[model samples]
Target: MKQRVVPIAVLAGALFAVNVVARLITRFGFDGDDTAQYRITIGMFATIGVILASVAYVRAQKSLPSEWLPSLAAAAIGGMLLTILVGPFLSGGYPFSAGAGNFFSQIWLYGGFAIVGILFGYWIATMLGRDYRSQSLKAFTAAKAGKPRRVVRR
Candidate 1:
């Protein structure tokens, strides 16, 4: 449990760093316009989706949710925090300005998008049945190539 938590925390931190970098880039690299900021946010989410899908394709189904969900949830939380805390500092704008809604809205927006991405990845992997095929092939090979089968003693 301790070992697992450590790695998850580290991965979540990495995800948070990605979000921070994206936010910083959008804040400084482009015009301080709402549309540009929104576009950058969208691109960041899309990148996350692609990454999750790739991970799902490579990861085994049995361990998919367990291994990824904690880190993902942590990342979502950390990402939201990064956006809220650093948004104003880097963008020279308040997180919830007069035009924007409450701060919690940011949390919902980021969480919803992250969850959707993760679910989409998991669904695609499951629909492809790669895990099942891999296990089946392994069983078949083991049974066929291993030593002769011994008769069962009732």
Candidate 2:
């Protein structure tokens, strides 16, 4: 439990930290500039994607998909919640200050980007034949090829 929770919590906190940094930049540097705020938000999302993608690539190398995927999902959700709920306060705004539609859109965007990043990482790992499943399959094939087949009387 500790092993699982600690990594997930750390990933979530990292994601939220990115949001805080973005918020602070926007609040201080572009308080009244809508264009700058939009650009910063997009940049924030891309940074989140890259972070998740790199983590996914590394985790895939170390653990089975069955073991790592759920934890990844949990971390993504935890991160999204922190970004959407606690982030606004740091920027002197409320969660729903932009209205419900914007709030929900943020959720959708976060989930979508997270999925895309994970998929991209998984694809790269698979292509490199370095992911857990690929390595296990390779080992199984090698072991099978090493053994001689027995002749059966028909």
Candidate 3:
């Protein structure tokens, strides 16, 4: 359990770090520029999505989705909370300075991206017939089809 948790926490921290880097760049490099801020935010979201998707893809190769999905979700949620709440302080701003709408919006955006990332990864795995469920189904069908048929007397 410790081994699993350490890696998950590390991954979550890494994801949060991406947000921190984006925030720093936006604050310092694009001060007072709404256009740049918007683009940076979108790019940050995409980066997180790509990270989640890659993690899912790699995990799918050796484990079932059920085994890793919960951990990934927990990590995402944890990292998101830190990014939204603690992140502002690093920029010398209050967490609620942006108002409740902004706070909730961040949550929604993060969650939506995480979900989409996981779905995209799983979809690709299924298409490639590499996911656990897909492989199991394939093997089951093959086994059934390969069995000899019984003949009935008329």
Candidate 4:
């Protein structure tokens, strides 16, 4: 359990690091520009979405949430923290500079990204026939295609 937790925490930290780099880039590179900062945020969200979707699609064959969900949740939280705390700095302001507006926006953006990413991941998983729904569909398809009419036996 300790071993597992360590890796999950590391993964979370790594995800958070991605946000850190992005935030730093936006903060220093696009200073004082709302338009550029917004663009960076969208780019980060899109990147996260693709990553999560890929993970879900790949891991759909697995039956254990204990294995994946924790990692994902950890990653999301880590990323959110990095963005929220470091993002304002990247945007050329202190962490809580704009009163409630920036703080809330950070929360909203982080939450939005996580939700969107998870949905995309789940959707991919379903589409790949690895999820339960996909398995059912596969079974139905196989049944429909595998045989001609058969006589009922009592």
Shift in Å, residue 93, candidate 2: 0.8
lDDT of 1 by residue, 1-154 (tens): 7866775566556656667778689866876587887888778767765655555555546554676666656655665576666655656667666345646766666667767777777777677766545567768998898878779998
Pairs with backbone N, CA or C atoms under 3 Å apart (clashes), candidate 2: none
Using lDDT, rank the candidates from best to worst: 2, 3, 4, 1
Evaluated at residue 36, the lDDT of candidate 2 is 97
What are the clash counts of all predictions, listed in order? 0, 0, 0, 1
Q: Which 10 consecutive residues of model 4 have the lowest summed lDDT?
A: 56-65
Residue-level lDDT tens digits of model 4 in 99-137: 888688778876787777777777767665577557767
TM-score to native of every candidate shown: 0.67, 0.91, 0.87, 0.71
Position 48, candidate 1: lDDT: 60
Model 1 lDDT on a 0 to 1 scale: 0.66
What residue pairs clash in candidate 3, if any at all? none
Best by TM-score: 2
For model 3, how does the per-residue alpha-carbon lDDT over 31-85 read when each residue is reduced to its tens digit? Answer: 8999998899889988998899888877786679889998988888888888898
Give the per-residue Cα lDDT of candidate 4 at 4. Answer: 62
* Positional deviation of residue 28's Cα in model 3 after best superposition, in angstroms: 1.3
Clash list (residue pairs), candidate 1: none
Off by over 4 Å in 4: 86-93, 132-154
lDDT of each: 0.66, 0.92, 0.87, 0.71
Name the regions of candidate 1 deviating beyond 4 angstroms.
Answer: 61-68, 86-88, 92-102, 132-154
